[model samples]
Target: MRRFYSYLIYKLYTWALNGSGYNTPIFNVIVTLACVHSFQLIFLMFIAFKCLPANTHLSGWLNYVAILAILFLISHYYVFYNKERWEGYVKEFENETPKQSLKGKIYVLSYLIGSTIGVIWLMYFMSVYLFK
Candidate 1:
């Protein structure tokens, strides 16, 4: 459990840093805004779900799917942009030899998968609220 929390924190830090970049303070501000937006959405979804009426299972599931789709779309846009920056960073780091290692490939793959999961989770919560 401790390790999981550590990993989660690391991932969140990476997400913020990668999304915003370290070039300027504006990136940090953007990261903060993004975090706020994400958290607010989650909270709203939770409240919405809690207030949902009974016997709305089908509606709730549909809401979940729609929420997931929307979250995926939005997160994908941000993730892609962040990935471009990451690739640029990689290119800069390998300027001399221009080599791609297995670790690098794995890292990128994991980043994409993890981000997708995060978006999906967000959508699921929203759906529960929306449908309820």
Candidate 2:
């Protein structure tokens, strides 16, 4: 079960990161929205809430938090550790004849802008929500 779950997560991450149509404007939007930090934050939040204790002052949540954190790291490590496989998928799915048109450039530019915003937001979220 754990192996299956890990495999599923890895595949999902690869798909989100290297979308089926990565060069397409819509797919780029999806990739921008599905950034790693966003998903990590969501998962950690869910685990924290689910493991929160009834006695608000209790520190029991720490154990669960730590365990979940390890699992989270493991899942991400698995995905990234298999970088060669992911790159192969990207190479396979990427456009055979790379787009050189103005529209293609615009799409790439939009993706870069959107990705920048997403990274900034993730940093802010970590500092504000996770740290303090």
Candidate 3:
């Protein structure tokens, strides 16, 4: 998980650096957002299906804030907390074969796309079934 996390951070950091020429803090936030969204889906899905006394509705703003806190911490560990760790990851894959690099990119892209679709589908399902 740490390896993949670093790779994802490196991928997003470089991409954001190229795309918008934003400074480091903005890129850090973008990476943090990606991590938050990835784990937030899992958290929501658990609430969707986990056994409980009853199907309960959470306050929308509260749910958002909780996930923002939990998963954001899980994702970035406070953006500026460990610059050495982030630097270690910055070029961790520099020596990889082209084939391996392509495969890694595919994995990252698939993860992003799958998590996004999962969230969209989960929202629709919740609205139609659970929240009804």
Candidate 4:
């Protein structure tokens, strides 16, 4: 079981990082989203079996997980194949825009705040489910 799980995880990591294109925002975004999608699946599956055991037999959850997996795979492949176009687009945008460190800092701060909220919400729900 441990070997199977490890092999599955290895395949997933290979899939997530299998782009042939150079490092760019498009590649980074797709990989990051794929990782987030993978994390979400792990979280939900753990919750389903450990917390909400009643829904363990439902096919809908499997369907939902499949959809998410497909979505991320498509997104990653799309970006990987069209990397040149994406790079050109990014270059054009960057050439037209001026650097604004303050704005960039603010955006980073906002993202951190949103991520904190999401983590807190997940913890709260997990606590409720596990304790109740």
Q: Higher TM-score: candidate 2 or 4?
A: 4
Off by over 4 Å in 3: 29-35, 38-81, 129-132
Candidate 1 displacement at residue 3 in angstroms: 41
Give the per-residue lDDT digits (tens) of candidate 1, residues 1-104.
54432333333444455664365433443354355445556556556656666575465576775787577556744743453454344344443222433454
Using alpha carbons, what is the TM-score of model 2? Answer: 0.34
- C-alpha RMSD of each candidate structure in angstroms: 11.6, 10.8, 4.5, 11.7
TM-score of 3: 0.62
Instruction: Tell me model 2's lDDT, rounded to 2 decimals.
Output: 0.50
Better of 1 and 4 by lDDT: 4
Which regions of candidate 1 deviate over 4 angstroms?
Answer: 1-21, 59-132
Q: Number of the top candidate by TM-score?
A: 3
Q: For candidate 4, lDDT tens digit of each residue in 80-128?
A: 4554554443343343223553454355445445445565677578778
| Per-candidate local distance difference test | 0.50, 0.50, 0.66, 0.52
Q: What ranking of all candidate models by TM-score puts the best one first?
A: 3, 4, 2, 1
Q: Give the lDDT of residue 115 in candidate 4.
A: 49
- The number of residue pairs in model 4 that clash at the backbone is 0
What digit string (tens of lDDT, one per residue) describes model 3 on residues 49-107?
45443546464746786876676656654553566765676668668788987898898
- Which ten contiguous residues of candidate 2 have the minimum total lDDT? 25-34
Candidate 2: tens digits of C-alpha lDDT, residues 1-132: 544333333334444555555554333333433454455565456545545665764468678767865676556444445435545544543453444334544554554465566556765676668755
